[model samples]
Target: MAIRRQDILAAAQRILSEYGLADLTMRRLAAELDVQPGALYWHVPNKQALLAELADDLLARVPEPSSRRRWDRQLTQLATDLRTTLLGQRDGAEVVSASRASSLDTSHLGKRIVEIVQAGGHTHAHASASRDALLHFVIGYTFDEQSHALMAEHGAAPARFGDSDAAYAAALSVVIAGVRAPTAGRAAPRPAG
Candidate 1:
């Protein structure tokens, strides 16, 4: 039977969940699929491309930004959903971060955030900045959580961080508060004398 792109992605996701990202190599994927390593290249040019596709597929579970709800509420929902989704998979945050850094993330989730921000009366630049800040916080925060869970699972040292869920909610609140802050009243920065 000929291998398809979806087949490769499904196998990759299984590897990621079962053994983590370090074990999700093309060679391992080919082994899982019972095909020659070169066969994977017919569907994906390289591991990075495959990872990007997988990341997008994983993020597809997140709910799209809703215009009907208040922007802040919608942002809260979106961020929470993203965190939940990332935590659902092994090394998921790492995969998504790599995809974003490589400019291979095609989920358009960031665009949705920006649109939500703009709908709240912010300028395009402000909305874009907010999107970046929000995503960085969500992704980085989730990454730490996943890493800690892995360490605990392997019988490593006890966690130094306490109550991650509460901490994350508080930090997310701070970020959303900043986004909701009025930009109009801020005094213009003065040039250094």
Candidate 2:
């Protein structure tokens, strides 16, 4: 059978799932695929590229916004979906955060999010800011939650809030309210003359 890029990615993902990001080395991945490490280079330039691919795969799982819902509700659902997707895999949030710092195409997700906010009567700048803030919150919150869960698995104390769902929901509500406030019949202050 021909060694395809997808084959390499699949093996890489399996390694990531079983061993976590810290252990996902080129040597280990090559061993997992029963190929020379050089062979992986033909498919992915390096380990960072492979990680970027994994991060993209995770983001791709985020469900599109529902058109029938109000903008704030859609944003809420989007944030919830993001958290769900990040928590689905071991070290998923780390992969995403690392990829964001790499040369990956994460703008599509951001564009969709901004569109949702814009639909709610926000200016483009405001929408973009709100979208970024929400994305940052979701990633940061989930990353911390997953890290603590890992600690708990190793016999650390249970999480203070029991789980992240309620905390995340409350935080998301605050962010959405802040984003919606300026548009809800309050005008921006004029620049000082």
Candidate 3:
């Protein structure tokens, strides 16, 4: 039977999950697929291309941003969804950071995020910065979470709750709180004892 592109990508994902991006060599992939290493060349030009394809495929699974809510909530939902997805797979955020927004589905998602920000009565520049801030924050946060997952796999407690909804609420609360305007020079929140 002919080798399929999806099969190659899926194999790459599995290998990345098992051995990490560093260990996923073309020869190893061929061994996994039970074919010659050259077989992958027909589907992807090089290791970088294979990595890019894997990133693209993984990022494509992030659900589209919705237009149904206040911009803050919409942005929060998008960021939280991204963080959750990245945490689900090994080294997922690292893979995402290596790939450009232009090279993967991220650019589309970024555009949607910016559109929501703009629609919320912000200036173009403000909306752009807002979108970037959220994206970078979530992506960075997810990378830390992925690292935590790796630790968890080694029998440590990340101790973070497993429920996606609750995690989102906790994270978004902090992130959205940061985005708020200064309270007209009001008193700062009291420090915890």
The candidate maximizing lDDT is: 1
CA lDDT, every model vs. true structure: 0.86, 0.83, 0.76
The stretch of ten residues in a row with the least summed lDDT in candidate 1 is 99-108
Q: Model 3 has how many clashing residue pairs?
A: 0
lDDT sort, best first: 1, 2, 3
lDDT of 2 by residue, 92-141 (tens): 88899888764322467788878888888889889878877888888888
Total backbone collisions, model 1: 0
Tens digit of lDDT per residue, candidate 3, span 23-72? 88899999999999887798987877887787777667788666677777
For candidate 2, list the clashing residue pairs, or say none.
none
Q: How close is candidate 1 to the true structure, as a TM-score?
A: 0.89
Judged by lDDT relative to the true structure, which candidate is superior, 1 or 2?
1
Winner of 2 and 3 under TM-score: 2
Stretches of candidate 3 exceeding 4 Å from the true structure: 101-106, 155-171, 177-193
Off by over 4 Å in 2: 102-106, 156-163, 183-193
- State the displacement of the C-alpha of residue 158, model 2, in Å, after optimal TM-score superposition: 4.0
Task: Summarize candidate 1's per-residue lDDT along 1-193 as a digit string, tens digits.
Answer: 8998888888998898888988878899999999999888878878888878988898898977676889999999899899999998889899999887955222489888888888889898888778888999999999988898888878884756577678888999989988888464689779999
